[model samples]
Target: MTGFPGVRPRRLRALPALRDMVAETSVEARRLILPVFVGEGFTEPRPIASMPGVVQHTLDSLKRTAAEAAGAGLAGVMVFGLPETKDATGSQALAEDGVLTTALREVRAEVGDDCLVMSDVCLDEFTDHGHCGVLTESGVVDNDATLELYGEMAVLHAEAGAHVVGPSGMMDGQVGVIRSALDRAGHHDTVILAYAAKYASAFYGPFREAVNSSLQGDRRTYQQDNRNLRDALREIRLDVEEGADIIMVKPALAYLDVIAAARAICDVPIAAYNISGEYAMVEAAAANGWIDRDGAIDETLTSIRRAGADSILTYWALEYARRGATR
Candidate 1:
């Protein structure tokens, strides 16, 4: 064989140590945040049908799960609530004894500051209509009225000891409203992780089932359209300007490009949500013996990190962390 004249990329590939040393991306337990669901009125964990392995956990189980995640050295746990009751105003969302608020307090007590506790600060779980905010007389989402509710929710979460409040509703000026509310409530140190580029994706199907969502229609009117890249960028920029401590793009796999772009433009950490449908697809395929479950998870998460996500929120976070510990 003729000698290569200008390039010799094979030399680095020939040595495993050299390849490892030069790896462009890596995923670690500390960079992964597990999303957990805690429900009121459930004495045991209730399985979510659409998401085979996921469950709506009772308060006791939720505390244990939070402790386990902290012991595993995972980044944190993002808690979602399923209230026992729902109404037009989502009254329970701001109540101190509400499902999420109570769960936050319990998880914080169990973990004892060992891990970060994040709360999902949206009204969908408590709202009868299953929209992210309160509705007007005409059944339209009232943006200004919703902002006031979001602000109240933020204060409630802060009081409940949430380390971070994830505003995933995609409401206009939500970050500013929540920030001001937290500051006024003497929670100035609390962080805001904005769902800056959340798209109205079909990938959230399993999530809806997990929270027992009764959504009457799609959220396309408020959530970013999947086809609009520029809009995503603009939203991210606006959130950053509005005091978001962390920025996120939901449904990580399909929107890696958006994650990369946001990473390039923003100074704050970028997070990607490896959403429910993504996890369900892997579980379904693995059950069918079409792929190695652990291998598929590692590859999928590695790709998201390589695409510039600083942290990832995934249902597989604990499993992946345990695997990494074994290795």
Candidate 2:
């Protein structure tokens, strides 16, 4: 019989309280941001088919849900608008009374200072083509044209009472332009959350449906490639230089490496989105009794926090908050 000389790691793992005491990371309720979809022209909340227990909230529903998010102690709620109409240039995105603007105002008013109201400052949900920006005559996305629109959109969101604006379009110089636009419009306090390393992943399928996206094709041209870690860091660095208050990596579960790597190099707070497909897969498996639903949700969120995300945007935020409150 032989015994190892090293200290036994099993001592810490033997008890739940000991494991909790020595845990490297924790998912606090205040660091989880709930992502909500507000649908225009809808009198009632519509349940999204692919995302179980999630709904496309109407104006009234959105207000109530956002209030719940505040009451549950979430750090913030991210609003995504599902407009009833769309056009080539997504003119509605900049309209004062646009669906998103309206929702943002209402939610901000309801949540007040209890929770941060963040808006998705992108045009995919408002454009007929479902691309993030305007198209050129050759049907390619116009980067410069898109940046102009993004700036306009940021001001609109600020005027609508959004505390933070997230530029998820992946357009070059988007964060800088948005920051400049906000300052010029007297929204100097508005924060910019840059989608720094958003990858063009296949896991966005459920999200497309969530926004009623009309994306005829992929956004691979603009979104970062999944295989390139160095490129992701480069994107993060550029966004930092351009004045990103907080940088983000999309599809958190698949890119924990990118999230951890960003945490190592970047000084700003890091955020990660637990996207729709990630939520749906766990729900599907749990529905069939393949895994414990509650446990899966907690584990996934804990893993993201463990990977060094300062905050997490997830569909499970409200539920997790409620559970934490009860516990």
Candidate 3:
């Protein structure tokens, strides 16, 4: 054979320094957001069986962890609360003394602008039925009514010192309602992180346990179908139009294409969740000697960034940050 017609690219990949210099995508600790689950009425951290190395943090543990996150230079920490009591309407969600609201205040105070303090604005963790919103007399989730509660919840989170509020319930017009609520409440600077194309995926199994879910049926009625790309883009566009500061796609690994697609038509920053099941699978495999944990973790995060996610919500954010992301 003879002279090649194209340039040889292996030279660029010949050394780590060469590869780093030419790398098109990089994962940084500052672009990774750690998702934290804070439990009410617990004196000690409880390990989550489904998620290895993750735990339900008590209030004290939660503040310590938030400080750790800030010290690690993480982009932010997202808070999910586990309440001791539940109800049909999830009244605790709006209570000033509620678990989540309290955690938000503590976390924000602990971090103190060092890292963003974000809160999950949904009723699932607080509702008795385990649905994301209140149900009708017929036992179906009321979309319009849910929007009203979401509006209130967003304001509460903002008032509690949340820099960003994520509405993951997938209720129609949720972003708009929450935006209006925040503006009216005089918290106009609070950012709205829309769970724009959150798919109703089975990968959420571990997450259900993490939050002690009381899901009655399923969220397919509200969460987007995994089979439809058009549906994802539609939701993303609508959220952007409705004042979503940043739009997100859930279950990042399986929906990298959707994440890339969302980036294509979006003018705002894009975020993707490296959800629980994805984390568990890798952890399980590593425990069983199936894969290198750090390697898998780095690859998983890098792939999301490569797919155009401006930031990633992940269980491994702190671990990855501590070990140093592949930057």
lDDT of 2 by residue, 1-327 (tens): 357756677999999999999998888889999999999999999999999999999999999999999998999999999888999999989889989999999998998989999999999999999999999999889999999999999998888899999999999999998998889889989999999999999899999889999998899999999889999999999999999999999989999999999999999999999999999999999999999999999899999999999999999999999998776
Q: lDDT tens digits, residues 145-251, model 3? A: 99999999999899899999999999999999999999999998999999999999999999999999988889888999989999889999999999999999998
lDDT for each candidate structure: 0.93, 0.94, 0.94
TM-score of 3: 0.98
Tens digits of per-residue lDDT for model 1 on 111-168?
9778899999899999999999999899988988999999999999889999999999
What TM-score, computed on C-alpha atoms, does each candidate reach? 0.97, 0.97, 0.98
RMSD of each candidate relative to the true structure: 1.4, 1.5, 1.4
Clashing pairs in 1: none
